[model samples]
Target: MEQRLSYLKQHLQQNDIGMAFIQGKANLFYFTGFRCEPHERLVSLMVFPNAEPCLVCPNMEVSLAKEAGWQLDIIGYSDHENPWEKIQQFTSDISFQGTMLGIEGELLSFSRAEQLKNAFPLTEWTKLDNIFMDLRLIKNEKEISVLREAAKLADFGVEVGVHALQSGRTEMEILSMIEFELKRKGISEMSFGTLVLSGEQSANPHGKPSMKTIQKGEFILFDLGVVLEGYCSDITRTVGFGAISDEQQKIYNTVLKAQLDTLEMCKEGTILGELDRKARSIITDAGYGDFFPHRIGHGLGTEVHELPSLNENNSDVLKVGMCFTIEPGIYVPSVGGVRIEDDVLITTDGYECLTAYPKELQMIK
Candidate 1:
């Protein structure tokens, strides 16, 4: 955490930004090694170019912040107290001139930003959203290790869900079973909502799991991930229940081919657009061009969706140690949909797939 803070301090010094108010929960946790959801409270990490960083939280969370490894100054306040006043106390102690202040524009609400602006009326505000993105794009060794373990649990999630599948089982029923089994293994939370879509519902890319029953000869889709040790994993798999039709098999094969072909091209220096095009081309040639709606995939890490989105318009080149997802899908409105996704780690020569759940079209009896 200190190393990350040092890097940020260097950036601030280089940019001539005197102070940075990290209000985003993710950024706050990343820099301070502390995690908390300050729902309506004013929680922030105040960092200056030369002075030590200070954490500001509710009075109740002061001890929790210390337990998270923050050793610097901590300012706590009650619900009735104005947090900005306490924040000003630390700034005044540091003799903060507030010439140039940085903040996360994307994560900060307008009301909060207004309060901050009022606090530093003379300071110039710079948005550090891109700076944070660039910093987190490449994963360190420890992060990759945790992500690898998270992927295993994601794979396990699919395994449990697939085995729990049976004719007449409602989508919600199977979704509940998957989460219950994962909890039995000590998984306290899912990275995102567990998705269990079947038949026509699967055709909707972001469909919600409902009481719709799973029937034979239809596609059952599972897209889920688990939050393990502050890291996250995401994977998607679709399988047939009992027997499926010829057209259904064709759709599934096309999606699998697209996903596999695109994944093979995931190596260092590969352009993001090239990968998206490769997958889109394969699916387009198979005559389902319009059916593939969303982008190929997105970057996955502490948050499921992060920087360096894999799409046709993004020209960013893939680099080593970067972990992201390569998910390709083909969704037909009426008939059904098929999507095969995998979490990939960019290596020197090629890439390694973190999510190892099989993508073969399974026929559950």
Candidate 2:
């Protein structure tokens, strides 16, 4: 937390911003080590180049914030009290008036912006999104450790889904089994809604789980992840319930090849756009060009999706410590879809795949 705070202060000095008001929950947790959901209330971290930082939150959360390892000065207010007025008081004490102010422009609502403008009419406000995004882009050692554990749990999720498969089971029943097993193992929540799409429903890339029952000679897609220690993991796998057509086998092989080839291309100095195109070419050559849709993958970390997107147009280059997913899929309406995804970590020499559930097309009896 101290290292993160020092970085933020250095950035503020370099940018010549007098003060930064951080309100995003993720950003707050990143800098202060305190995470909270401040819904319908004003919670902020006030930082200055030379002065000490301060945390403002609901009066009821002052103790909770301290327990979370935030040692800075804390200001609390009740629901009836005007938070903007309290903000003005804090700013006045630090002489933060008529100078450059930095804020999360992307997160601040229009009403909140107006409130800030009305509070400090003479202050100049600048957007701090880029500054903070860059700060959290690379994962530190501690963060990487948490993410590794999260990936293990995500692999466990797929394992459970595959074992729960049966011809008479509905998509929802399988989904319930996955969640129930995770909960039994002490998992409180999933990184995202668990996805268990079967047969024709698998054709929709982001389809919701339905009551449709599994059948012989059909495909089932399992896409899920778990949140462990504030980090997240996501993975997808498609397996056949029983005997499948030769065309289905061909499609599955094509997607698997695309995913495997893309993972091989994931190394330091690799351009994200070219990596995406390499995978796309494999699926295209297999005569499923139109069926393969969506970007190659996306950044993964604290949020299921983050920075350094993996797509055909992204010019970002892969760097060590950067984590993202490599998911390649071929969706055909009225038939079925096949997708194989894996979480990958960019390493100094090469790359390491975090999610290790078998990608081989499995047939469940």
Candidate 3:
């Protein structure tokens, strides 16, 4: 945590930013090793260029923050108290005129921004998103270890979902089973809403699970991830409930080939855009280009979706220690959808497949 804070302080000094107010939960955890959800309350980390940093949170969480290894000064406020006023009191001794203040503009609410403006009326506010993104784009050994564990849990989630599949089972029923099993294993949160779209509903990329019963000879799509140790893992697998048709098999094969081919290119210095094109071209050649939508992947870490978007238009270069997902799908409104996704980490040589779930088409009996 100290090293991360030092890096941020250097950036502030270089950019002439006197102080930075980081409010994003992911970022707060990144810099302070403390994860918190303040909901409507104000929770932030105040970082200075040459001075010690301070954490601000509700008085109730002050002890919790200290327990999380935050050894710095903490400014705790009550619900009836104005947090901006508390922040002002803390910085009253520091000079603000002709100096710039940095903030997470993307995550700051309008009302909070207004309050901040009133507190530091003479100070200029600039975005600190790029600084935070640059700091978090790469993962360390500890982060990778946590991610690997999360990926394993994600694999287990798909395995449970596959086993719960039945000819007469509804999507929600299977979805509930998956979560219940995860809870038994001590997983407290999911990266996103558990997706268990079956049959025609599977054709909708972001469809919601319903009470509709799944039938044999249809496709069942399971897209889910578990949050473990402050890291996240995402995996998507589509399986056949019973004997599927020729067209469905062909579509599934095309998606599998695309994902495999793209994974082979997950090496250092590979352009992010080319990975998407590689998968897109294969699906297009198979005559399902239009059916294949969305990017090839996205950066996975503290947040389910992070930096370095893997799209056809992204020109960012892949580097070692960067982890992301490789998901390729073909959805046909008339024939259901087939998607295969995996969590991967770029290594010194090539890449490591974090999620170990089988990629081949599975026919659940």
> Highest lDDT, which number?
3
In model 3, the Cα lDDT at residue 202 comes to 94
Global lDDT scores for all candidate models: 0.90, 0.89, 0.93
Write one digit per residue (lDDT tens) for candidate 1, span 20-100: 899876678778878777889988998888999888999999999999889999999999999898887778878887589
Worst window of 10 by summed lDDT in candidate 3: 90-99
The per-residue C-alpha lDDT of model 2 at residue 94 equals: 85
Query: What are the runs in model 1 whose C-alpha is more than 4 Å off?
Result: none
Q: Please name the candidate that would achieve the greatest TM-score relative to the true structure.
A: 3
lDDT by residue for model 2 over 11-65, one digit each (tens)? 8899888899998877888888777779989889998988999999999989989
Residues 1-365, model 3: lDDT tens digits: 99999999999999999899888989999998888778899899999998899999999999999999999999999999988887888887654445798999888999888888888888898999988988899999999999999999999999999999877789999999999999999999999999999889999989999999999889999999999878999999999988999999999999999999999999999999999999999999999999988999999999999987999999889999999999999999968998999999999989999999998999987
Question: After aligning candidate 2 to the native by TM-score, how far in Å is the CA of 158 from where it should be?
Answer: 0.9
lDDT of 1: 0.90
Considering only N, C-alpha and C atoms within 3 Å, which residue pairs clash in candidate 1? none
Q: What shift in Å separates residue 133 of candidate 3 from its native position after superposition?
A: 0.8
TM-score of 3: 0.98
> After TM-score superposition, what is the CA distance of residue 89 in candidate 2 from its true location, in Å?
0.8
